[model samples]
Target: MEKEFNGRDLKLGQIQDGNSDYTRYHITYKSGDLTISGIMNIPKGIPPEDGWPVLFLNHGHIDTSVYTNGRGLRREQDYLARQGFAVLHSDYRNHTQSDKDPNTETDVRLGYVEDVINAVMAVKNSDISSLSKERFGMLGHSMGGGISQAVMVVRPDLVDAIVLYAPVSSDVVDSYNRWTLRNSSNAEKIRSAHGSPEENPEFWKNMSPRTFFDRVKTPIIIFHGTADESCDIEWSRETRELLLAAGKRVELVEYPGQYHEFGATFDDFMKRSSDFFKNNLK
Candidate 1:
């Protein structure tokens, strides 16, 4: 049975001042029955006349065994916060301090997408008068990029712009097939619990961003490394093509030989993302 979502308010709480130009808070927001936890980075100086714009940060997949509270994109979050944007990074359910779920293949890990969307809603409706409820953007890496695409399809007005880094394919079925190639037994279990991709195409279709490209209205900038092994660079290229064909605003920035994590090119990636948000969100 699908759980009921009420889009409840966030119980904002400040954990620390960050001891820098940005203040850090530990946020707890209601996402269904479970309360999710994340770090919110707020600029310490005076707020703009219209309040500070928000940037939702979504991270890539990390092994649960070694994942920490701010695993995938902590550095990127810090950089964004320093750039004068309020950044929120969720731990996501079953990863760190958040709740758990019985996720399956056809579902395509939309739970993480829900967690991110709920977090955005929480910030928009929170009592923090200094944060802008109107202006919002997104930065997603790897699997998080896929989540951002899905979110854009469902909530076109939620974010004004998005930045992606080496994202997975918009096709959830293809992503699941990649997973199955590495772990056949686990893939079979997920398929048995849900239905195989061939038998339950609709389920996969509903979970994929590719199925609803026409609904994506926000402008997006994609950064992909040609040498990336985890997520194929071709996926982002194809997604860019689809979005363009649908008449949506899209741009793809390529890195010649960088890997999935971007390693030495991390700083360049950050600058491009920061610039994109600055230009679009304003």
Candidate 2:
């Protein structure tokens, strides 16, 4: 998993105009044999000597069929870019214009992790004069946060810092109970093929990021709202506890009355997020 994913052959499509602080463009980067589509935002000013420090933005779970390029993290894309960071928001495989992944449903979507790792490599290998080459920061929301967790464990040095906003559990067993088998009809298909979490602890552990938290070198800060109904705040609490037990650098900030998506507290949240990346990423 670490030897490859050197992102290559980046292609930027037509420019998107509207924002005043940064320039937006549609883009594609190689992820294995697949061509992943995404959106990028470059701040509309001169980059620092080492180029703009980057942020790999990962979005929450949206129905893939209806998802568009940079759909879920538009606010972050713009907000982070305007604050002088190059933002790469991947749509992941089989979403938006990315190539289809035939094994997505059966597999645990580890391919999404590949896409992000490759995205980091793409920026590192690109000829863009304004992209950073040092350790980058990543921000993931909800299911995307789960993917970022895998990214951290799979390649600890790939990203130096991570911000998880109302993330899902790092444990696959918890995830399976909360999402996969909760109200979905795919339980039989999953159990028939790979057995249930209770029936197959090893399989679930192999699929979990918590199993590899001891390998994580990235500094992480998590933000969760008390009233987030879609994803319980307890998830982040448990995740932080596990990370702390592993002796990892981590912090968890709980908003007293916020929800799944930050509303009244978004500005303050972004401010802290901005500071976290600035203080951690090199």
What is the per-residue lDDT of model 2 for residues 1-282, given as tens digits with 9 covering 90 to 100? 445777887777878754778889899999989999998988877789989998999999899878978899788888888888889899999998999998775677778988999999988888887888885999999999999999999999988899999998898777778778764556767777778988987888988899989999999999999999888899899999999999999999999899999999999889999989988876
Top candidate, metric TM-score = 2
Model 2, residue 174: distance off in Å is 1.7
lDDT, candidate 1, equals 0.83
Global local distance difference test of model 2:
0.88
The clash tally of candidate 2 reads 0
Cα displacement (angstroms), candidate 2, residue 171, comes to: 0.8
For model 2, the superposed segments whose C-alpha errors exceed 4 Å read 1-3, 182-185
Clashing pairs in model 2, backbone N/Cα/C closer than 3 A = none
lDDT of each: 0.83, 0.88
Query: How many clashes in each structure?
Result: 0, 0
